[model samples]
Target: MRLSRRDALAALVAGGVGSLAGCGAPTARSSPSSREAAGDAAETPVGDHELATLVAVAEAVYPSEVEGVGEFVRTYTGSRVEGAGSYARGVAEAVGTLDDYAAEFHDIEYASLPASTRRETLEYMSVDDVAPDPDGTEAQRVRHYLVNELLYALYTSPTGASLAGLENPPGHPGGTRSYREGPDA
Candidate 1:
């Protein structure tokens, strides 16, 4: 289900998330796999609930418990060496918006909403593509940090190479270059 910016803003307003003073809401979301679950336990500066929100969003994007794509992204963001702090902060903020929306709308956290509803919420955000308020809203924040940026990081990184099934990813130290052969001759 797509929502135009106006519709999305109206929906968010109806949900009452727009009235929130700050992005401070508790949320419950599950890690995708044993590795991610383990990753989830490692602890980071980002709040546990906030991290869970990130993981939950990841699950929605990849939908694979074993792949742990989202968890991997989380790890990548943390270890990024330069901008990790900024990325983490942005995601934490977006998750706050999501949690607030969920709490006010369904009387449950966004992560706790039924899977279909969670997906719809994300779809709504993707389609709307605008913040509900002057300063900002969670939907736009989530799309920017979690959806677009996170996916870009995933698909463009060495980790994305694994997902794409490359024998030697773009910049490995000493791996064979297989793509030069081209499709079967």
Candidate 2:
């Protein structure tokens, strides 16, 4: 099923994906100073190019049935990058690596490629074969910063959890009444 932006935001909040200083809200668009004021000392301002590249990567990785991939990825990845300096650097490096590869083989940036081409580029890079590792080789870093990161964000959200048949994923209370009901209910 297609998830609206509102649904995605609600799911993110329920999953505690972007709870900065008890704000319990998505802060993708929050300024650097605001994020710091909220106690996110590690908050790194992700560049627009990086975010656009991430959205492109998400389009390749996420299932076609999933909607609002851009906003969801931006919100989730933005929050994740904010929480860790190393992670932000890794994401930037990974995007650069992907772009370099795309330019070499496809004569274009990764984000400029069509979705199918982007997926093909990822497959050609062997991202799936490599384990996610921030300090590992290029493929591993891409898996860590791009592939695994996106997958983790998607699966952790309520909308994405439902894709895996998890009606009540961890962190999502789903209400006390849900506990008394059967899985099918």
Highest TM-score model number: 2
**Superposition error at 141 for model 2 (Å):** 0.6
TM-scores for every predicted model: 0.54, 0.76
Q: For model 2, give the 10-residue run with minimal summed lDDT.
A: 22-31
Q: Write the per-residue lDDT of candidate 1 for residues 24-49, one digit (tens) a residue.
A: 22233332223223444334325556
The sequence of per-residue lDDT tens digits that candidate 2 reaches over residues 1-185 is 55556545655676555343222122232123322345444545356777899999989988999988887777767665654454575676688789889999989888999888999899899998888776677788889778887887777666788897875667665666755777788
The positional error of residue 96 in candidate 1, measured at the CA in angstroms, is 0.5
List runs of model 1 lying over 4 Å from the truth.
1-45, 63-66, 80-85, 126-137, 158-176
